[model samples]
Target: MKLSWSVEKNNQLKAHPDRGICFEDIVAAIDHGGLLDDVAHPNADRYPGQRVLVVFCNGYVYGVPYVQQDDGTLFLKTAFPSRLLKKRYMGGDDNGKKS
Candidate 1:
């Protein structure tokens, strides 16, 4: 998948306080990290015309918000560290969900 970042996403990522994590980090994680799931953004008001791809990377869960164009280009909207842990991406018996 081809990846690109929007101007707003770049600015937001630069302003974020998450130490050692940059736009490159999010891109690398999404490229090599384990994918959790792809779902429509629950808060459509905040993430318009985008979906969220949850990924497990470096023992942390990162939510990558993006949109895929008709030409198969991925336009990354933004990314943030989710409160979930690595275990959430593992396996679950009760919920029967991997993530």
Candidate 2:
């Protein structure tokens, strides 16, 4: 399965590649559909869309794998390692603010 991580996530994993990706198994699930069943429901409609996925770096990490409608392509959108995982990974903030 094809998967990727962001530059920041790459650095974080570089520190400990062994334990860097506890959710590596998620990669397999990417192609098979919710193999890990860890992704939360979507809270908003935005770019990149929300889908269920198993993140390797940590529970804080959120990722989306998609099959391209153009040519039946499938790839990773880069694992996002952030506290944003709690909100379906659309990038927002506290105090009721959306970014």
Candidate 3:
């Protein structure tokens, strides 16, 4: 899938160097068959236009909120690491409970 993000958003993401993740990482993860799943944002009702997806890549999970353009490109609104998502989707025990 094609991916795109605004320059401003990119700048905002870059500001946090500690995150150790970039747009290229996201792309590579997707290219290499990273697991993708659609999820409802906590504020879904407030932002109804975009669909949020979580992806697992390189042992890390990211929350990617995006909109599919008419031309089929995914316009990524933002991306950030999500521990809650990783635990929920990456096949791990929840609070010591077996799956």
For candidate 1, report its TM-score: 0.67
Which candidate number maximizes TM-score? Answer: 3
Candidate 2 worst ten-residue window by lDDT: 90-99
Candidate ordering by TM-score (highest first): 3, 1, 2
For lDDT, the strongest prediction is 3
Alpha-carbon shift of residue 86 in model 2 (angstroms): 2.5
Model 2 scores what on Cα lDDT? 0.42
TM-score of each: 0.67, 0.32, 0.77
Off by over 4 Å in 2: 1-19, 22-24, 29-61, 65-69, 87-99
Q: Give the Cα-based TM-score of candidate 2 against the true structure.
A: 0.32
Per-residue lDDT tens digits of candidate 1, residues 1-99?
687887676776777667234567766777774677887887899868888878766556667778888889878776666654334565433222222
| Alpha-carbon local distance difference test for all models | 0.67, 0.42, 0.74
The positional error of residue 27 in candidate 1, measured at the CA in angstroms, is: 2.6
Better of 1 and 3 by TM-score: 3
How many angstroms is residue 19 displaced in model 3 relative to the true structure, after the best TM-score fit? Answer: 2.7
Task: Give per-residue lDDT, candidate 1, residue 28.
Answer: 74
lDDT of 1 at 15: 78
